[model samples]
Target: MSDFLTPKATPETAPFWAGAAEGVLRIQQCDACGRHYFYPRRFCRYCHSTDVRWTTVSGRARLDSYTINHRPLRGTESLSPVIALVQLEEGPRMLTNIVGVEPDPANLVLDMPLTVDFEPRGDMTVPVFRPASTGSAEGTR
Candidate 1:
């Protein structure tokens, strides 16, 4: 395993990290505006409401954009990571990694369906995405 840094949770982000540890993706939802947001802030990004509460969301997303990292990080010289931006089903976008497929433009299709998968980093589990289609690793356009 690579020596990747694990996220240290603050009071505002503890619930999100806790949910990820249990294979659940949690985001903050504004009770006032009914808008969901990510990055685990105390207030809603859309409406700036303090009445935001953490809720579990569908682990489904769409591939919005990405780049293949040809130069691997230290201790991961053999791996070319796919750094991706995914738009969640609930309408928030997050920066995550695409895994279980080749890091090539031919395989990374825009608007491709994705499903969340967790990977262990140090003691914490972080969210990564894989193609939603079964029996194949390549993304479908």
Candidate 2:
């Protein structure tokens, strides 16, 4: 077990974490409905079919929403991470941390183009996002 706090992986979520460890973003796509979804599951949220398969994604996303934490959680007093929901390019939204930028509302614009980055925590790797290096800030509301 790792000293770092992390979500316990169920069988369904293992592939996601495995892909993260390899620096790849992974999600599930429903073969039946042609919709992509996050938080690995046995069935598709759209079609309710068991035909979902793990797929690698571009790791590019848009910041759908976020909140900056000035207060640190217990045992993590030295770090303040930005909690955010990002809409993946493949159209799935997932909870993640926003990194490589000031954790302020003025800097964390909604719909900002973002790219994935990973941090190793004990036995697991966590995916985080940052503003895309080459994109304009315009319309990133």
Query: Judged by lDDT, which candidate is best?
Result: 1
TM-score for candidate 1, please give it. Answer: 0.89
lDDT of 2 by residue, 1-141 (tens): 337676667899999998888888889999999999987889998889998899988888999988877777676653437899999888989888888888778998899889888876667887888888885443122
TM-score to true structure, per model: 0.89, 0.89
Clash-forming residue pairs, model 2:
110-141
Q: Candidate 1 on 1-141: residue-level lDDT in tens?
A: 555566788999899899889988888999999999988887888888899898988888999999988877677654339999999999999999999888889999999989888878778888889889765453222
- Structural RMSD, model 1: 3.8
What's the distance in Å from true for residue 89, model 2?
Answer: 0.9
Q: Please give the CA lDDT of all the candidate structures.
A: 0.85, 0.82
